[model samples]
Target: MTCKEAQNLVMDYINRNLGEKKLESFLKHIRECKECYEELEIYYMIHFAIQRLDSDEHASYDIKHMLEEDLKEAEKSIRRWKIRRSYRYGMIVIAEALLCLIILTQIQGLNAGSMEETSFYRLFFQEETDR
Candidate 1:
């Protein structure tokens, strides 16, 4: 196998994924060519590093932790909004109730003050005096 052929097959050889016939040819080339052996070592190291970074346990744990933190923040935001909404609704109800009380009191006051001379007591006293 030439250096170029061995270089092309380096990745498959490192992964042990080459066919038996190609594996044998690739190994023979590496044994005879110091340059091809070094190239294989370089490619193998790079592939291993990539695989380590892609490990399911480490990568998934980090991602899961971040998602959990985000969920917690979202829950906190929802709780804060609920509290504010409740306070706002409570304030609006109180304001409306106070407005109703004020209006009722004003109407009662108008009826009481407007009945001075035309009131029932004044008319009844005047009729008795005339009789």
Candidate 2:
């Protein structure tokens, strides 16, 4: 992602509104681009600060740690999503293969039935057929 694109997605990233694929890309860009990472960090600090102001709680909050945790959680979420998607894809493939095998079995049964009816061996005795 370009700096411009990453900059545009800063709020979405902070809000956790990005989809898994989009988030993955954004995270990759943020980790690699120093300027963009700093920009995101600045935005996160401001956003968190505003939230803290509105809340009645007086506990001290670690903004930097919170940001790091957010990033790590996002990564973990993306990995879990990827694993689920892969399993789903694998199941679909297996289902398709089973359906194909069933169809082939049905076709073979029909062909066998037709062959038995039309073949000349049926007209003869079992002993002659063996000869």
Candidate 3:
């Protein structure tokens, strides 16, 4: 087999999943090519490292620990921002309500003062016309 073909079949050979003819071809290539042999060794080392972790009950813990920490920090920051935004909106609402109330009060006071002035002018003109 060519080096490329053998390299492709190396994983299947290591897992004992290759057919008899394919296995023989892959093994022949391994025997002839030092580079392919070393490549296979490195592949086996990585495979074994993963396999060793496979049996550990806490494998998920190690895998997700950093990600979970980051997620929690992100959630906290989002919540803090949301709370700050809500307080800002609340303060704006309150300020707008107070401004509306002040305007309404001032308008009512001006209307009452104008009515009193108009009544005083009507009374004074009626008395002068009678005289």
Taking every candidate in turn, the Cα RMSD to the unseen true structure, in Å, is: 25.9, 7.3, 23.6
Local accuracy of candidate 1 as per-residue lDDT tens digits, 1-131:
78898899987765556765676676667768889867866665576557768774353234334433543554455567668989999999999997986676566657787533343544555776656
Per-residue lDDT of model 3, residues 35-88, tens digit only: 987777766666656876787644333423443353345445556766898999
Pick the winner on TM-score between candidates 1 and 2: 2
Instruction: Give the least accurate 10-residue stretch of model 2, judged by summed lDDT.
Output: 116-125
> Residue 31 error for model 1, in Å?
1.2
Best by lDDT: 2
The superposed Cα distance between candidate 1 and the true structure at residue 20, in angstroms, equals 1.4
lDDT of 1: 0.65
Q: What range of 10 consecutive residues in model 1 has the weakest lDDT sum?
A: 59-68
Q: Judged by lDDT relative to the true structure, which candidate is superior, 2 or 3?
A: 2
Q: Which stretches of candidate 1 lie over 4 Å from their true place?
A: 56-131
TM-scores for all candidates: the values are 0.40, 0.82, 0.41
**N/CA/C clash count, model 3:** 0
- Order by TM-score, highest first: 2, 3, 1
Q: Candidate 3: which stretches are off by over 4 Å?
A: 57-131
For model 3 the TM-score comes to: 0.41
